[model samples]
Target: MLIRRAKQEDYCVFAAIEADCPGYPSWGANGFAAEETNRNSVTLAAEFEGAVAGFVNFWILRPQVQLNSLAVRGDMRRRGTAAALLGKTLEYARKNACTAVDLEVSELNSPAIAFYLKQGFEVVGKRPKFYNNTETALLMRKTL
Candidate 1:
């Protein structure tokens, strides 16, 4: 799997990946298009066999990185696509002198929680009803 910067043409596939994981918040094609104007935003796409397989978006806020969104195609899970994307994020963090990576995951998403834990993230807090004011959000952080 190859992880690289996302292009405008890849937004649709990114959106589809978001859809493949239900209950995950989505930034549709238009939303991703708007990210082009954010100087701090970094969006990455994972490619497998020449096809887009997943995506991750984050912001490099000096001293830290805020992981905003991440998703892998349902058929591509456990193939290291998500891990590669995250590895790139950590590379960016180290390059930028960031000290930590932060993100929030839906409390009900067990797979994601496990993934984050396995990736060295610790639950630092929680925001009740953070997801559509319905599901709780587990705030996790990895101190780099």
Candidate 2:
């Protein structure tokens, strides 16, 4: 997989990936495009076999990196595409002198929770009704 900065053309693909992921809080293509104006945001696309397979969006906040979103195509899951995207995010965090990576995932998304746990993240807190005012959100963090 080739992980690189996401360009305008990749936004729709990212949005489509989000659409395929049920329960994901999607930031539509326009929302992804708008990130270009945010100095703190970094969006990346994972290209596999010449096709966009996944994407990750995060914010560099000096002492911390906040992972805003991540998703991989159903066929791309477990193929290291997601991991590669996340690995790049961690690499950026370390390069920026960030001490930790933080993110909140829907409590209902057990697969994501498991993935993060495998990536050395630990659940540190929770926000009730954080997802559409229905599902709780599990706040997880990995201290570098």
What are the lDDT scores of the predictions, listed in order? 0.93, 0.95
Model 2 lDDT, residue 41, Cα: 100
How far does residue 70 in candidate 1 sit from its true spot (Å)? Answer: 0.6
Off by over 4 Å in 1: none
Point out the worst 10-residue segment of candidate 2 by lDDT.
74-83
lDDT of candidate model 2 versus the reference: 0.95
TM-score of each: 0.98, 0.98
Candidate 1 lDDT over residue span 105-142, tens digit each:
99999999999999999999999989998899999999
Native-to-model Cα distance after best TM-score fit, residue 54 in candidate 2, in Å: 0.2
Candidate 2 local lDDT, 1-144, one digit each (tens): 899999999999999999999989999999999999999999999998899999999999989999999999998898888789999999999999999999999989989998999999999999999988999999999999
Q: Return the top candidate by lDDT.
A: 2
**Reference-based lDDT, residue 38, model 1:** 97
